[model samples]
Target: MTALTTLGLGPLIPLGEALPPPEVAWRLALVGVGMGLHGGPTQALVLGAAPPGRAATAASTLQLSRPLGFALGPVPAAAVWGLAGQAHGVRAGIAFAATAAGPAVPLLTLRRQPSTTAG
Candidate 1:
């Protein structure tokens, strides 16, 4: 959140738009806290659900996904920018990360779901 301040996200901030400043601030704070809570719990859940020696591998898989998200995020923007114009392309990129990646998260729930045993 602090990092976004310098990134020039004033456009993302709502001062006159439908969302009031208070609402936007609340959501922004939730997003920051949510990321922290999600990270460790997700890793632990994945590892806990894995069978036997696979626990380490499952955790590694989760770690690998971090870079995968980073790598994949720009592709949609590049594609959108190629097909569309500047602003649309940027929106497309953000949608790719916020929505496309959002759905992929449900797939991770499988790894988090309880199994017969935790190794």
Candidate 2:
């Protein structure tokens, strides 16, 4: 669900160019909603799945990855934008972002195995 919402962002962003200010604002708000829906469940899943004694490490790693992803995500997008040329740069970059989300779809289908340790 979260991946699908994120996948929608790339196509939605470019539409802002042709949309009025109010329309763009609402779409951006929707993006925020999508992000909010993903964040908590993701954190919970990570924390819940951590080894019994490694919750702190799992949490810290998760925190670190968020910023790293944010910082690194644009690198490829920018490269795509540059390669595409100014005329279509923004759209190409956004399209690249959409493609990047593709892998998450399959990943989301994975189920966590039941813990072998007895309570």
Candidate 3:
């Protein structure tokens, strides 16, 4: 589900280019939906995979990373927007976002390996 949503988002966002305000709003809304759909499940998987006594540490690390990602994720897009000028900035930003999301799909879909520790 996470991989699917992430994959869909890459193309869906860029398709908003040159669209009217309402159309763009819908695309952004879908992006929000996609993020929301994956967020909880991803967090659960991260926490679940944590070693027995380290759940709190895992949770804290996850919490910290979320804000850090939110803050930094837009930097490249913003840089592109600034460099490309207003006429093309929006499209450039969208392209940057799509490009960034593309690689994440495979990572999201990767199978977890079995634990090797002696039981």
Candidate 4:
């Protein structure tokens, strides 16, 4: 999911000209689909991994990450763009965003709880 969200922007970096309207729409739709695909698994993982009594805190924190990233992550991207111009700077930003997911991916995968069996 994180990979999908970050890497989805990759193709844009290499484009030499503004995309046609249909292509723009198609890419936006793919991003939307990627985001839609992200929600369920993330919710399940965050809520499920809550230690005994911290479910609400866990869920809230999970929810908070999005806005926090939105609020903070763009600063460096903008800085890079200011320094390097659009193509290289945006590539730097995209690379940073994609690599940022690397640490979190292992953590998410580690919580494979066994299914409960009915008595």
Per-candidate TM-scores read 0.53, 0.77, 0.80, 0.66
Query: Model 4 Cα displacement at 31 (Å)?
Result: 2.6
Residue pairs with clashing backbones, model 3: none
Error of 1 at 92 (Å): 2.6
Off by over 4 Å in 4: 16-24, 101-107, 112-119
Q: Estimate, for each residue in 1-119, the C-alpha lDDT of model 1 and write its tens digit.
A: 22222122233332322546665666556555645556776676677678887887888888999679658756875676567664465444444445543444456545343446667
Instruction: Locate the minimum summed-lDDT window of 10 residues in model 2.
Output: 8-17
Sorted by lDDT (best first), the order is 2, 3, 4, 1
Per-candidate local distance difference test: 0.54, 0.73, 0.73, 0.66
Scanning candidate 1 in windows of ten residues, the lowest lDDT window is 1-10
- Steric clash pairs (candidate 2): none
lDDT for model 3 comes to 0.73
Candidate 2 global CA lDDT score: 0.73
Candidate topping TM-score? 3
32-66 per-residue lDDT for model 3 (tens digits):
77777777877898887898899999989998997
Cα displacement (angstroms), candidate 3, residue 55, comes to: 1.4
User: Which has the higher lDDT value, candidate number 2 or candidate number 4?
Assistant: 2
